[model samples]
Target: MRKNIMNRLPVILPVPAPPPPAHRAEPVLDLAVPVFNEEADLEPSVRRLHAHLRETFPYPFRITVADNASTDATPLIAARLAAELPEVEWIRLAEKGRGRALRAAWSASSAPVVGYLDVDLSTGLTALLPLVAPLLSGHSDLAIGTRLAPGARVVRGPKREAVSRCYNVLLRCTLSVGFSDAQCGFKAVRRDAAARLLPLVRDTGWFFDTELLVIAERAGLRIHEVPVDWVDDPDSRVDLLPTALADLRGIARVGLALARGALPSGRPSRSYAVPVTVMALAHLLLYAALRPAAAAQAVNALSLMACWVLAQPVLGRPPLPAPPALPALAARLAVTAGSLALLRHAAPGAGLRAELAVLAAAHLSLALPVAVARSARGGRRCRTGSAAS
Candidate 1:
């Protein structure tokens, strides 16, 4: 049997995320800081974050230092912080992927809300409240701190800025997504939403963040965006080329899934056999009523289009496909036109039975493969780690 990848936790983390912060009631929010080799910065960062949360946050909070296969003193630093602070805890994973670390930490969190922040703290801490407020108040399913949104301030090299803008634009143009930024490290989710979305997100690296947000949006969960003040971390370990290439591949994978209406919604997808039968029957009745050749052909075309729409499927909370996007809508129309044209120009003398046959043959052969799917809420693709999240 192909066992779930999430079960293969680093031996060091035989235990899950740290026990509820000792002495305090269970936290309302748990902040995950996923790290690899950051001995020089982890301790101070955690301390700084702890101080900020203690001073500003209204409710109890927990900080989990998720060290993913660090080869340096990072684990030691994280352990020390966990030992010294009542609100702090740490976990060590065997693998180095950030997505893997987050999966482990977030999956084990008990708080009503769970979120992650990069250890470098590139985004200012002030946005933290707005980030979680929506989830806490039951106004939003997820909250994100976006550098690309209006009123946000960002200081990054031109290259990074360009890449960020381009990547977001690609998401808008290809996926027709509403969120301005997909990979912002500063984000939080209501536990219930996370529980539903996590298992379906597939990427295990940087793309993990984007995948999670995409799934949340597609599932009809509300997302609140916070315009954050951010400063670029020069020491950031992310390699632009590899990350960008990976993101492109991720986009393509997701786009194809949306196009096929194959995104898993954590439910059993219904068979379309019934819808097709209904469509065929409806077309016959409509054509019988509108006997003029052009009108009868039009009726046949409309029924086929309706069948295509009803058959589009996406795995989601509603187990519904996104309304088709422009390309898809166009494709469906073109096919409908071609099908009607064929019956009119090629088989003008055909009887009613022959017309029905040709209509069915045209749609089965030409239209079903190409069209009807993915609205602005285009299906979000979930990958491996996320796929089993």
Candidate 2:
């Protein structure tokens, strides 16, 4: 019986099976070093970065050299470094803007966290881990190494420092931006956040950082600031005046867009009582001041019109979803006329004091709800627009 069973199984033969597909781990970080024409600093900086990352970095990483239309030997040096280092890569772009290079490199990378630092490596490498850790752990959507932050140590001349401070102040006053430093080169963004933001950013030059931050803030994304020890690179090729002028132009454009409600925000709605009260007080004061000089009807009409004009940018136009522009204007005109009529009727026998009081109260009661509704609408629009984008 044993012999018969062995004969029955005689046709079976052992055949080799193919090996399973290899599982390759994705890189956790892609640090881009964008350069225009830094042939001399390219190799040394990359080698130093590679060494630092290799020694202390806790995860897999890659160093990308983004050469943006370099006329010298930068491309050659970058290629040589990429060839020498397994974790290094090079990308050559036809354009010359740091923003363009960074955008291209980051968009092409598959890493979960993509970041770029100045080729000069003016920022201390010790901050590298802190800069990316928030993004990796999902504690923040973006992280920036801020030289202006309180704990930061910065070494730069008086002129550069003054310029930096003044620029930031201008941003606060004009754009109402919350970020401390917008021009810092040491910045990182999660790939998902970058995908949503990069399309909305219009600047392809030095102002790119500011544009990115402004849009991100408007979209209600959380930004993490890391104080860094930084040394100014004396060999930097940036022209101060031209760059400043360009940045100002960019600011003006962005500010105008924001005023027109063209740029949307993602922040939650807040109590409108304070702003509404302030506007009401201001409006009352304006009417009182003009009451003695102008006719009652004139003063009332002017004050109401002035309030509407001033509030257009703050509360936004078409505060409610109503009819077309012509009809809206007509409705506003009618409302203003009715308000004046109501004021006249309320104080027909009383003095100017009584009339002004009645006028203020009536207008406040009517405008407060409108203002609140407008604010709420604006907030909703911001969230909706951000989501759609």
List model 1 lDDT by residue over 1-389, tens digit each: 11333344345552234455366677899999999889888988899999999999999998999888877777767766787787888888887788888888889888999999999999999999989998999999999999998899999999989989988986765555789988788989988888888788888899998888766666677889999999999989999978976776676556555545556433222223223333344444455445564665466556545644544442112334433444554554566567667777886877766665665565455424423332222334434446678
TM-score of 1: 0.66
What candidate 2 gets wrong by more than 4 Å, as runs, is 1-24, 268-389
TM-score per candidate, chains pooled: 0.66, 0.66
**Model 1 poorest 10 in a row by lDDT:** 267-276
Collision pairs in model 2: none
Q: What value does the lDDT take at residue 305 in candidate 2?
A: 66
The positional error of residue 154 in candidate 1, measured at the CA in angstroms, is 1.1
Q: Would you give me the overall lDDT of model 2?
A: 0.77
